[model samples]
Target: MSARETFTDRWMTAMSHAHRLLLKASRGQLGATLGPMKVVELHTIGRRSGKMRSAMLSAPIVEDGRYILIASKGGDDRDPFWFSNLVANPDVELTVGGVTLLMRARVADAEEKAALWPRVTAAYGGYSRYQEKTARDIPVVICEPR
Candidate 1:
């Protein structure tokens, strides 16, 4: 059973739907870039409903054919729905710059997160502020091309 939506959840859902619509209308071109960061469309199977769900996320670091995503959720205490879905099913699809590819997602361990945290903060300083806003340990997810 789905939980009742709080005001924050409702707001987030509305914004996500709008972004998704824009992303789809442009064939993943327009909304693919957010300021200095590049955005990618992550497609995953819903953990409960078993349906495809897409989220636009910033890929602050891409190295060695791996795309790194931060599960900051704007620093919310709870993990994002997409993060949960990714954890349940690592295999997913990603559309970057209009090209879709199969990928495997995994949460970075504490050591790995520590190593990449600097790079992540450097890429976007706003993340640092987000970290300060919440007590939960934000996750760093690595998506490698399959």
Candidate 2:
């Protein structure tokens, strides 16, 4: 990884840790929402280690009981680790607003992405900027109740 990418990864790791701590410290009262997005704790089985892993992510779009997540990784060229994990094992657990539910995750197909991209960028323009920073097409993930 380039120096900038390495730094970004480290920063993201730290922020996720802090976010989880905040949620735990507040007993799910705080860190549940961020700006216009809802924060969710996504748990997936590690692809290589065969262990459970989790990440704190924001749901940019929630429609028809489905949560849409962006696998931007701050616009990194490589896919995020969490994204790979979910691809290997779609069965996941999502915790939102102190409610935990079993969910299945899948990458949105091209047609779905085309329709949702505008809404996602509108919800957070930063996502547009993130897309511009990388050559790879960032994936849009959908998590639905299982």
Best-performing candidate as measured by TM-score: 2
Clashing pairs in 2: none
Relative to the unseen true structure, what is the C-alpha lDDT of residue 90 in candidate 1, on a scale of 0 to 100? 97
Per lDDT, the best of the predicted structures is 2
23-125 in candidate 1: lDDT tens per residue?
8898776777777677888999999999999887889998788999998888777788999999999999988877888999999999999999999999999
Q: Residue 126 in model 2: shift from native, Å? A: 0.4
Which residue runs does candidate 1 get wrong by more than 4 Å?
1-5, 26-29
Question: After superposing candidate 2, which stretches have Cα over 4 Å from the reference?
Answer: 1-3
On residues 39-146, what C-alpha lDDT tens digit does candidate 2 reach at each position?
A: 999999999999999899999999788999999998888898899999999999998877888999999999999999999998899999999999999999999988
| Clash-forming residue pairs, model 1 | none
Residue 87 in model 2: lDDT: 99
